[model samples]
Target chain A: MNRKLRDLGERRLVEWIVRRLEECEGASLPPGDDAADMLFRGRLLVSCDMLAASTDIPPGMDLRDAGFKAITSATSDIAAKGGKPIAYLVSLMLPPELGLESFEDLWEGFEEAAKLYGGRIVGGDLNSGREIVVDVICIGEAGRTASRLGARPGDILAVTGEFGSQAAGLHALLAGRLEDPEARRVVERFSRPMARVREALELAKTSAVTASIDSSDGLAESLYQLSELNDVGFLIDDPPISAEAERYAEKFGVSLFDLVFYGGEEYELVLTLRSKLVEKAVKAVEGVGGRLIPIGRVIEEKLIKVRWADGWRMLERRGYQHF
Target chain B: MNRKLRDLGERRLVEWIVRRLEECEGASLPPGDDAADMLFRGRLLVSCDMLAASTDIPPGMDLRDAGFKAITSATSDIAAKGGKPIAYLVSLMLPPELGLESFEDLWEGFEEAAKLYGGRIVGGDLNSGREIVVDVICIGEAGRTASRLGARPGDILAVTGEFGSQAAGLHALLAGRLEDPEARRVVERFSRPMARVREALELAKTSAVTASIDSSDGLAESLYQLSELNDVGFLIDDPPISAEAERYAEKFGVSLFDLVFYGGEEYELVLTLRSKLVEKAVKAVEGVGGRLIPIGRVIEEKLIKVRWADGWRMLERRGYQHF
Candidate 1:
């Protein structure tokens, strides 16, 4: 018999959840306590992200991908600070009619993401609501952390990985182009954007890198955030638009500039580094099987300027805004 | 000029939030990093709670109370473990049409609650959604913590404060009896329930206490939780119903038993302690301007039995279940 969630009651549901969780590395207490206990070294880094079904989850995404994306989005913030994730506390609000099998799938996705990021789910809260809402609170540790305010005017602006792929993937998914191989690849990128944890940690160990942010809110928005925090401007010589994004833009008759500059959910780390240590930063990222693409320089002027085929144009501070 | 949330955008909203938060103690890094950093001593205790508009909030409760209640609910878990709250991360999912003043009111409530609990809002995420949802992730510290699985057969079961006050208040609110002073008092109790942090901390310092849990899911439900975790049962000699609740039950022609045993959101810490040190536990609670009411005892038998005016009755394990 397929048992309904209401038949299991809250305690039985908790037991099911507890049984599924593997023993976390640094957890001192088990999952049944009022709170889970963990021992950590160095400075503690904490960030939270909430993914709502109506707002965060797009078309063609399953519950598993939603769960994975929720955790990845929060961990991406930790990566921006050059911190290694230690643990996660998830708070899930589910609809009353949600089935047990779907709940299990969501947890499986959460565990898969934790395994990929080298963190564990130590504790969480489960409640009932109108729509599915997953709030992930990630705890990380760092010896020395990067901040957006530390960039200087003469620093070189660089980013990890290509941009606009997730945006293009989202477009393709919305347009019912899921069967195409290229479209599938980009959509996969949207579903599971890799957090730059290894690359950011490597850069944090060096004195070269200064300011940093996760490019989840589009490359232009990330640049604007850094500029606002450091009171400086960015002059981009090369906008790193991925080939797939370019193709999607051409085929769909959409603005390539919009795809590259304003699209969100990239999960790439955008950083400002010392001009002389650009090669060192590049080598460190490459050592981790990642590429550091330097595209611009920070300027004293407090405006963002991008170079196109025509000439330099001032870009508006636009990206994904929840409200 | 009344500004809507969508008009202000996410960046401006964040700036508004940042300006409102005072510098929290023990936070090494500021709020803008991927995560806030905190220095701590002893074992780190972490818990999270999410409150959604459709389910959690009752009629007549404003946005400020919603925010305060959200943080308090999470901190109540920390209190159950005898931990002192250090910081909180708030993630808000707001509808776009929400006014700026209402947003400010929500933050004010969060700040007020943190100040009351001796913690601070360190960091958070703000997103758009159909309804308002607040998720609070609390981090606390403890030297020696209490757990549900530690109760012995001979342990004296005790609870902090009176039961059924919050339940009575909820009844009054739902019944549209807001004008009566007694009803108003009960409603206030439901609106602003106190977490027994100081009392729990004091109890943790002594060797008398063995097992503990917060009675957020009603008194019977809490006893069941302890019973299940410790592989034991409870013999209740006294049901800790408040005088106000009894009066309310009589006036409303409702069952007093249901009001006291199955009502939720009390935020009282239920504990099992050594019978010999019952006086010590009472005195410790009194030292913190609280009362410890001994209601039961733990037994080896795996069933919960209650002593009523009629006779001993086997209590049904029923309480509020989210699913």
Candidate 2:
């Protein structure tokens, strides 16, 4: 007979979860207390993100990927602030029919992500709901944090890794191309997006970096946010499209520009920095085994412009919107 | 024309929310950053809770009460730890059809609760979903924290305020008895439950208190949790049922004992303290304009017993379970 969540009861389930968690760094009090206690060395950074099954999960995704995506998405925000993640508190709204095995798998994936990012699952809340909803609240620390409002007109605009992969992945998934290798890779990119913590931490150590944001809302949306926050604009000469994404876009007959500019959940770091320290920033990211790809420069025009081989065109300020 | 969430767009909605938020206390970095930053003077206490519309909200309850309940429920955990609330992060999963006015009202209620508890809404995540789901993560500070595992054999068991009110309220709501004064009071109690932060902080100042927990899962369930954690049992002589709850129970033809023992979401603090310092604990609670009602004593035995005027009976370990 298969055991269900109802068989174990809420308290028993919580006890089982508590037993499975290893002691995480910076945690003074763990799961058994009314609240987890932590000691932070400096300024505490906190970010929260919620993933709903109906809105966040696409086709060909399971609970484990949902769990992983939830944490990384929140951690990406912390990374954008150039903060080192210390602890996470996850609140799960699970349906009653959810199996005990599935719950364990979800938790395993959640714990795996926390360990990979050097953060611990310090506490959480579980409640019955109509669908699976995972809300992750991440806590971190930073000595000096980067802000979106710190970008200047003459700053260089850069991004880590490449874009359009997640968008391509979503397109493939929606098109039911699950077995294709390129589709699988892009789907994996969408499902298991990694936070740019290492690169952001390295960049934060230098005085070169000004404004930073994680590209959870696509490159164009992120640039628009940076522009709005700092009252500036961007002039893009190059758009970094990953080779795999390029292939997937071509195979799926999707526009490369649309994929790169409007694809959300990339989890790449988009940053602005002083032009003089470009080499230093590049070297710092390289030290972390990541490349800082400069795509554009902050401009005083207050309108985004992108240059192509044929001509220059003004890009519409559009991206994913939840509502 | 009425504005729907979809009409305003996520970015515009967020901008509206940011504009509405006043500068919160202890927030080094506020809403616009990747993560809100805070400086803690002592050990940071953290707790998270999620409320779903399908399960948590009752009949006739609006969005404002839902938001208030979400924060206060989480605040109860911090209070159980005898921590002073500093900041709160709320992640809301809202349906697209939800109006802008309703969203604003929900946020107003959330902010109201935070301010009332001496905390503030520093940051949050908003996403589209099928239903309204509020996940609240609270961060607080404590110099000397209370734990559920601290109860000792022979300690006196006490609770702040009465029980069964929330249960009575739920019953009345379900029965459609919203017009009665007693029902109204209980419904109000259930709708706007206050966390016992002030009383817990006062009790923490003295060395009298040992174990502490919030009565979120009804009296029996909370006691069972305390018993399991401390490796002890409780012998109860008095069950604190409020007069309003008693009247509501009688009016509804429900057992008073059942209502008191099985009703959840009370947000009352259940605590165990040294026998000699019961008076001191009571005085401390009184100093904070609250009352500490002694109900039982801890025993070395592993079974819980309840004494009535007629006879003594063993209390079954049963309460509300989400599954």
Candidate 3:
């Protein structure tokens, strides 16, 4: 029996969602309280992001994936600031005709994110709208956060992992190549993208990282943002492109440069560290079972250039635009 | 000249909104940063509420009122828990056809709320959706929160202010009676509702408040919620109905009982106070330039009743259902 949301009503739906959430430890006030209570020691990191069905969810994505992306993408901002997420407050606006089983799947995706990030889904609200829109608010704590404005000349530029997999994954999914074994890796990367929370937490504790940002807005755009904010430039001798993306680019006759520089939703950490302590930072990330791939170095000139076919070429300052 | 959002692009529009925000003192990271930073001493109260143009916006309300109410209604949840709002993070999902001037008016409304609530609009995101949707997350600090589970038998039930004005105002606006002199008062209440932040804070500090809730979902529903949570009943002998609402009821031949019991969006605080310290609680609320009107008392039976012409009649457990 498929029960629709209108049959459950708003109050019962809220109660159902609340009951599904795991009990948060040390919570003075639980989900039933008027507001969730969080205890933090130092500076609090807060980030809010909205994921709408019209723009955010691509074709071949499920409601559960949307829910996971809603929380994961917002937590990416906290990961960029080098913080550990403590709690999440979600607000969902859904169409009335949605089925109850669909909502359960959507909330199951949120539960998956909570398990991965170690943050509790403390409380939230459910409202009726024209489409499925999930707005997530993540609260975390930070010590010596790495803002986008701290990179200086000669700082070593690095990333948590290889890029371009997400872009390739989307292409594979859209081309109806999901059954291909070669496409499975890239497809999983797009559907179940992981934020570099563990790497960021470990890197921030090393006292060597200067600036950081999540590469959710593509590599070229993130570099441009850092350049504009810090009044510096970047020289990338090596681009960290995933092997799966290379195979996809070769098969589909797509430019690897565009895939690596212009494609977004990678959720990799683009960061700068002290030149002298690069080895220590790499060791710290490795200690947490993560890879730190050094891409380039910060320069004095206010132009981002990458090593192309013959010589250095300027990278365009454009990325995925939401509006 | 009118400029649409598609002309400005997402990055430039974000820059425009960030520039309009007032500088927050002691904020380590501002709007452009990866995440906002807030420093608080005690338990933090976090509440998130979403407002969509289709369901939340009434017929006569402007975009400015929508913006103001979006923040005010969310802040009301924090106020109900006896928390002082410290920071707000807003996430907007807008359509591409929206004009820049209209967006400016919406931001102006948000600025107005910031000024009134003393909470800085620290950081947010802008996304493209099918319609205008605003989701607000309020972070606050509370010394002692008045949860709905704290109400006990023999407690004196009280309210921060009278109700039904908002209901009357909605009626007046829908029926095209805005030009009437008496209608202006109710219309203003409906359009520009105020949250009882000051009174809640003062009452919480007095150590006399028991359980509290915001009357946003109508007086009867709030009473039913309190009853279900605390396993106690309410006996409202003197229903605190506003004079404007009574006038509207008499003029239009509407039921005064329905207006006082079932009308919503009042933003008043329905609370229970210690029987012996009622005087102290009243004084504390008055000290903050607000009123504390005693309505009735909490009873042992788990059923809400109101005094009518002959005797007390059972008040229905119903209110505004969003779905």
- Docking class for model 2 is medium
TM for every model, in the order presented, reads 0.97, 0.97, 0.97
Taken over the whole model, the C-alpha lDDT of each candidate is 0.85, 0.86, 0.86
The CAPRI class of candidate 1 is medium
Residue B253 alpha-carbon offset, candidate 3, angstroms: 3.1
Q: After superposition, how far is residue A261 of candidate 2 from its true place, in Å?
A: 0.6
User: Best by DockQ, which number?
Assistant: 3
* Model 2 lDDT tens row, B1-323: 67889998888888888776554555555566678886554588889989988888886887788788888999999999888888888888999898889888889889889989998787888899888899999989887888887888999999999888899988988888888898999888888999999998999888888889999888888998889888999899887878988898778789888888888989999999999999998999999899999999999998888885587878887787789
Stretches of model 3 off by over 4 angstroms after superposition: A22-26, A309-311, B22-25, B309-311
Docking quality (DockQ) of candidate 3: 0.76
Candidate 1, which segments miss by more than 4 Å at Cα? A1-9, B1-3, B26-28
Residue-wise C-alpha lDDT for candidate 1, range B165-219, written one tens digit per residue: 8899888988989888878888888888888888888887777888889998898
TM-score of 3: 0.97
Native contact recovery (fnat) for each candidate is: 0.74, 0.82, 0.75
Q: Give a tens-digit lDDT track for model 3, residues A1-323.
A: 79899988888987887786554555566576668876556778988888898887878877788788878888999999989888898888999889999989899899899779989888877788999999999888887677887899999999999988888888887787878877877888888888889999898888878888998888888898889889999999988989989998888788888888898888899999999999999999999899999999999999988897688888987788876
Each prediction's DockQ against the real complex: 0.70, 0.75, 0.76
**Model 3: per-residue Cα lDDT over B250-287, one tens digit each:** 98888888888898888899999999999999999999
Model 1 residue pairs with clashes: none
